[model samples]
Structures are given as structure tokens and as C-alpha cells.
Target: MKAAVLFEAKQPLSIEEVTIAKPAAHEVLIRTVAVGVCRSDLHFVDGAYPHAMPTIPGHEAAGVVEAVGEEVRCVKVGDHVVTCLSAYCGQCEYCVTGRMSLCIDAAVRRPKGAPPRLMLGDVPVAQMLNLSAYAELMLVHEHACVAIDRDMPLDRAALLGCAVTTGAGAVFNTTDVTPGETVCVVGCGGIGLAAVNAAKIAGAGRIIALDPVPEKRAMAEKLGATHSFDSAAETVADEVVALTRGGVHHAIEAVGRPQSAATAVKVLRRGGTATILGMMPLGEKVGLSAMDLLAGKRLQGGLMGSNRFPVDIPRLVDFYLRGLLDLDTIIADRLPLDRINEAFDELRRGETTRSVVTFG
Candidate 1:
């Protein structure tokens, strides 16, 4: 199989002939159909986040099951599925507590001394996250994937794995956004735009979308934002507060920047909550004032939207099929595996909502 392999930080990923091992117990092998070029992958490739070298960088993906281990019962051969990075061990404390996204059990991966799942000649290639979906095929734990309806298009289904799940899940699960709530979303990228769409579905009384890019702000309005502001004006937070009388009930930060995260806190009403969904730098810190906390303003971080993939994804599929979720507008371009570098270039420029890699 051919895969895009990252050898060094801030370097281009090279296309190489890689070898994929068969499924281990509780693992599944999938034929990659569509993989979204997400901003999270850029975090590792551009050295914003540290990762093991010689790894395959991709996680947001949708594919068809080609094979499964003897103990795998969640999906069968030929079943369509979406892959997630939040793989869990069913017996973990977090899993039993209904917080499966926080499960960090080491047993989810093969035991030490076991053969690698991916190899380039004789050297082992570390898999990015749990599902290295940048390749022609992926071998991952069954818990990392959820089977979805076959009618969902693979390219659109790929978005549900990460951007959609993280964005919408933050609204539906992480924050208590009531039907009449006011929402202000920072950054109009894939994740931010999804939050705007979900706010509309949640019946937000007013949805304000903020971004420096005019194109993205326009896109946010088309998706569902009642108001859009260009952060370049240098008054996004004030504009949001002004539009909603005092401040919004919920403010979501999706850019992963310290400033954007701070703005999420600035645009919240009393007793409102700010959910930070973007993956910020490892050592960076976001600051908030003591007065804000005293007023009952809450700032929180969400991992993979604190998702329970097994239940959330199928219902998300239903939302898409019913024309509630806007996957069609989310896709900006579709490229082949060999052109992965160009896809990342576009991502860095924030030129597109999402670029998808379609396999043959």
C-alpha cells in the first residue's frame, strides 16, 4: 500500500510504498475511501505539536471494512465506517463513567514486543493518533471506528469523524446550550463553521460567526450564522457583546490560538460557558480574569467534543441524510493521495473549509 509518510517536523510528507499488517485481536483493517485534510494534522506536521517521527499523519477518515479480527463484532467485512482518534478500552474508569473520550488505556494498542501495524521495509512506521488514514489502507482497533449507514457518501462521512464530531459535539455535549441561547463562534474554519450550523439546529436565538477571512465569514452566514464579523476589524468580541445586548450565552473557540481562546471568554454573558475545541500548542496557556470567574463565566476545554462515537455518529449520519447537517458545503476540494502536500498548503493558508483525499 502507498501512504504519505512524515519523516521530520516542518517537512513535506513523502509518498512511499508501505506495508500494512493484518488485524490483531479486536482490530479491523479498512480500505481507505475518503480522508479529510484536517488542521489537527498540520499541528503535527508544522511542529506545533510534538509527535514521533516517521509517522503517518491523518485521522479524519471514512472507509469500508475489508477484514476484522476474530473478536471484532461491531463491524463486518464490507461495512462502511468512520474512524476516530478517541479509541477506548471498554473497562477503563473513564469509559465506565460515560466519558469514553478521556480513556487513555494503553491496552488499546498492541502490547510491547508485538509486531508493528505499519512498516516501511524493515523499519516500523508509527501510526498517527490511532487510525492512520492517509494510506491506501488502515489497521486500527475496532473501538476507534463506528459503522455508519452505507447511504452516507464517503467523502462527506469523512468530515463526521473529526471536524463535525468535534464542532457539533461541543454544542450538543460539552456545553449546555439551550434552545434560546445566544452563541458566538470564533474562527470560521471547518470546526467553527460546524458549530455555526449546529447552533442553528439547536435553535440559538442569535448566532455570531467571527473570523479574519471574509470568505469564511460569508460561508458561515450561508451555513447559519445570524451575524458575521471579520476579526481583522479588531473588535470581534465587542461586536458580539453589542449584538446580544451584553454577551452571548455560549462562546466557542475553534482556532486553537491563545488570542482566540481569550476572545471566547471575552464574549460570554454572565453564567455563560466557553468551550475551547481547537488543539492549541502543548505549552501555551490561555488566561482569564478573576472577575469573569466570579461572575460565573466558565472556560472549559473539550477533547474530540467529549464524544461517545458509537451513538453520536449514527445520529449525525441521520442528520446529514435528513438535510440537517451541511457536509456538501464543508468540502472545498478533493485530491488524490500523491497530492497530499498541496492539500496541507491550502490548509495553512486557510484557503478552504476542508480538502479531502480520495483513494482509488
Candidate 2:
């Protein structure tokens, strides 16, 4: 199998021939169909988070199941599936509590010193978030993937794995915006735009989409934003407060930055909540006023939009099929594995919503 491996930070991802392993008892083998190039992948390439060297970087993906382990019952061979990073161990405290997104059981992956599920010749390269859809094939825990309708295109289904799940989940699950709620999303990338679309679907009275890039603001309006801001203008928070009678019902910080996180907290209404969906660097903290927090406002975080992927994905696919969800508009480009470097470069520029690697 051929895969694009990260050789260094901000460098080209080298395409190489690699061997992928078969599934274990609780895993499945998927032949890559299409994988969305996500911003989260860039976080690893740029060293935002520490990952093993020569890693395969891709998670937002949908592919066909080539094989399944003995323990797999949810899907069968030749089934079209989308992968989710939030693998849950059903017996964990979090899973039993219906907070499976926070499941921390050791059932998914083995600890260090144990044999890995994937290998490159003699070297054991890490799989980013466990999906590794950049390669021609992937082996992942059965719980980490969900089967979608065959009618939905694999390329579009791939985006639902991450961007759509994160963006829509943040709105429908985490924040629970009422019909008349006012929302402000801090970034207009894939997840941020998803938030805008979700806000529209949620019937937000006023949706303010904020991004430094003026062009994304335009895209946001097309998606569902009632108003869009460049965010480079004077004070973004002040502008939101002025637009809304008081403060926004919810403020979402999709950009993983300390300043944007703090800004989300500051702009919420007296009892509103701010949902942080970005994967911020380890040990970084966002500061907030104690007085404001005491006023009943709250700060929260969402992992995979607090998703139950198996159930949520099918419904989203239905939403897309019925013309409620718009995957056709968000896709910007589709390239091959060899062009992975170009895809990463385009991501750094914030040039488009999503780019997918379509396997031949």
C-alpha cells in the first residue's frame, strides 16, 4: 500500500510504499476510498502536538470494509464506513454515564511495549488518532467506525467524521441553542462553518460568523450566518455585543488559541456557555474573569461534538440526502495520495473548506 508519511514539520509528506496489517479481534480492515484533508492533520505536521515520527496523518475518512475481526458485528465486508477518533470502551465510567466521548478505558489500544496494530516494514509508526486514512488501507477498532448508507458518497461522508460531527455536535449536543438563540463562531474553517450551518438549522435568531479571512465570512453567510465579521476589525467581542441586544446565547471557539478561547468566554450572555472544540496545545490555559463566571456563565469543551457516531452519522447522512446538510458546497478539492504535500500547503493558507484524497 502507498501512504504519505510526515518526515518533518512544515516539510513535504513523502509518499512511500508500506504494508498494512489485518484486523485483530475487535478491529476492522478498511480499503481507503476517500479521506478528507483536515486542519487537525496540519496540527501534527506543524508540531502543535507531539506524535511519533514518520506517522500517517489523516482521520476524517470514509472507506469500504475489506475485512472484520471475529468480534465485529456492527458491520460486514464491503460495507461503506466512516471512522471516528472517539473510540469508546463500553464498560468505562464515562461510557456507562452516556458520556462515551470521554471514555478512558484501555480497551481500544495497547500501552507502550506492546505490539502495534500498524507497522511500516520493521518500524512501528504511530497512527494519528487511530484512523490513519492517508494510507491505502487502515486497521482500527470496530467501535471507532460507523457504517453509513451506500448512497452517500464516501468523499462527503468523510467530512462528517470530523468537521460535521464537531461543528454540528457542538451546536445540537453541547450548547443546545434554542430556536431564538444568538450564536457567534470564532473561526470560519470547516468546523466553524459547520457551526454556522448548524446554527441556521438550529434556528438561531442571529448567527455571527467571525474569521480574519474576509472570504470565509462570505462562505459563512452562504452557509447560514446572519452576519459575518472579519475579526481583524477593532474588537470582535465588542462588535458582537453591539449587534446582539445584550450578549450572544452561545459563543464557539473553533480555533485552538488561548486568545480566541478567552474571547469566547467573554462574549457569552449572563447565563450562556462557550464551547471549546479546538484541540489546543497541552498545558496552555485560557484566562477568564471570576466575576463573569460567577454570573452564571459557563465554559465547556466538546470531544467529537460529544458524539455517538454510530447513531449520529446515519442521521446526518439522511440529513444530507434530504438536502438538509450541505456536503456538496463545502468540498473544495480532491487529490491523490501523492499530492498530500500540496493538500497540506493549501490547508496552511486556509484556502478552502476541505480537500480529500481519493483512492484509485
Candidate 3:
């Protein structure tokens, strides 16, 4: 199997012939179909977030189950599935309490002595986020995936694996964006645009989108933003407050930057919550005034949109199939896996919404 292997930080991923091991008792082997090039992966590529070297970095993906382990019952051969980074150990306290996304039990992974899931010749390659979908195949815990309808396009389904799930889940799960409430989504990348679309579906009275890119702002409007602002032209928080006549009921920081996270807090109404969906660098702090806390403004982080994939993913797929979810607009283009490096370059330049890498 060929995979894009990252040898070190701040370097291009080398396309190499990697070896994938067979499924273990609770694992599944998938024939990679389509994988989205996400900003989260770029974080590791640019060394913004620390990660082990010689790993495969693509995560947002959908594929067909080629085989399943003896104990895997969630999916079978020929099933179409979307992979998630948050692989839960069903017995963990978090998983039992319905917060499966927070489950960090190492039990979901193979024991130390077990054979590596992926290998580069004699060396083991660390799998990124449990599902290294950049390769021709992926071997992941059954808990990390959920089967979707076969009718759904793999390219579009790939987005649901991350961007859509995270952005939309932040609206529908992390925060309560009730009908007639105002929402302001900071950053208009793939995740930000998905939040705009989700806010509309949640019946937000006013959906304000903030981004420096004109093209993204326009895309946000097309996806359902009631108002759009360029973060570079003026103060985004002040503009959002002015437009809403106060502030929004919910604000989402979709870009993983300290500035964007601060702006997400600045645009929140009294008693409103700001959900930080971006993966910020470790040890970076997001500061808030005591006065803001006194007014009941809340700031918190959201992992994978606080998802319960087994339930949420299928419903999301249905939404897409019914024409409610705008997946077609989210996918800017599709390229083969060998062109993975170029896709990341496009993401860094903010030139495309999402570039998916396909196996075929």
C-alpha cells in the first residue's frame, strides 16, 4: 500500500510503499476511497502541534470495509463507512456517560507487543488519529468508524468525517442555537462555512460569518450566512455586535488561532457560549476578562463537535442525501493520493474550500 509518510515536521510528506497489517479482534480493514485534506492535518505538517514522526497524517475519510476482525460486529465486508479520530473504548467512563468523543483509553489501540497496524519496511509507522486514510488502506478500531448509506458519494462523505461533523456538531450538540437566536462563526474555511450552514438549519435568526477571504465570505453566504464580514477590513467582533444590535447567542471559533478564538469570545451575547472547534497549539492560552465571566459569557473547547458518531453520522448522511446538507459546495476539487502535497499547499494558501484525495 502506498501512503504519504511524514518523516519530520515542517517537511513534505514522502509518498512511499507502506505495509498495512490485517485487522485485530476489534479492528476493521478498509479500502480507502476518499479522504479530505483538513486543516487539522496541516497543523501537524507545519509543526504547530507536536506529533510522532514517520506517521501517516490524513484523517477525514470514507471508505469501503474490505474485511473485519473476528470480534467486529458494527460493520461487515462491503459496508460504506466514515472514519473518525475519536476512537472510543466502549467501557470507558466517558463513553458510558455518553461523551464518547472524550474517551482517551489506550485500550482501543493494539497492545505494545502486537504487530503495528502500518509499517514502512521493518519500521512501524505511527497511524495519525487512529485512521491513517492517506494510504491506499486503513486499519482502525471498529469504534472509530460508522457505516453510512452506500448511495452517499465517498468524496462528500469524507467531509462528514471531520469538517461537517465538527462544525455542524458544534451547533447541534455543543451549543444550543435555538430558533431566532443569533450566531456568529469566526473564520470562513471549510469548518466555518459548515457552521454557517448548520446555524441556518438550526434556525438561527441571524448568521454572521467572519473571514479575511472574500471568496470564503461569499461561499458562506451561499451556504446560508445572513451577514458576512472581512476580518481584515475592520474589527470583526465589533462589527458582529453592531449588526446583531448586541451580540450573538453563540459564537464558533473555527480557525485554530489565538486571535480567532479571542474574537469568538468577543462576539458573544450575555449568557452566550463560545465553542472553540479548532485544535490550538499545546500550552497556548486564551485569556478572558473577569468582567466577561461576571456577565455569564462562557468559553470552552469542543472535540469532534461533541459527536456520538454512530447516531450522528448516519443522520448527517441522510441530510446530505435529502439535499439539506450542502456537501457539493464544500468539496472544491478531488485529486489522487499522490498529489497530497499539492493539496496541502492549496490549503495553506486558502485557495480552496476542501481538496479530497482519492485512492483510484
Instruction: Give all TM-scores, in the order shown.
Output: 0.99, 0.96, 0.98
Clashing pairs in 3: none
Ranking of all candidate structures by their lDDT, best first: 1, 3, 2
lDDT of each: 0.92, 0.86, 0.91
Q: Which candidate is the best by lDDT?
A: 1
Compared with the true structure, what per-residue lDDT tens digits does model 2 show for residues 215-264?
Answer: 78898999989998777676888888888877899999898888789878
Q: Could you tell me how far off, in angstroms, the CA of residue 253 lies in candidate 1 after the best superposition?
A: 0.3
lDDT string for model 3 (267-349, tens) is 88888899999888888899669978998999988899999999999999998898888989978989998898999999999
lDDT score, candidate 2: 0.86
> How should the candidates be ordered by TM-score, best one leading?
1, 3, 2
Q: How far in Å is the alpha carbon of 90 misplaced in model 2?
A: 1.3
User: Which structure is stronger by TM-score: 1 or 2?
Assistant: 1
What local lDDT does model 2 show for residue 19? 75
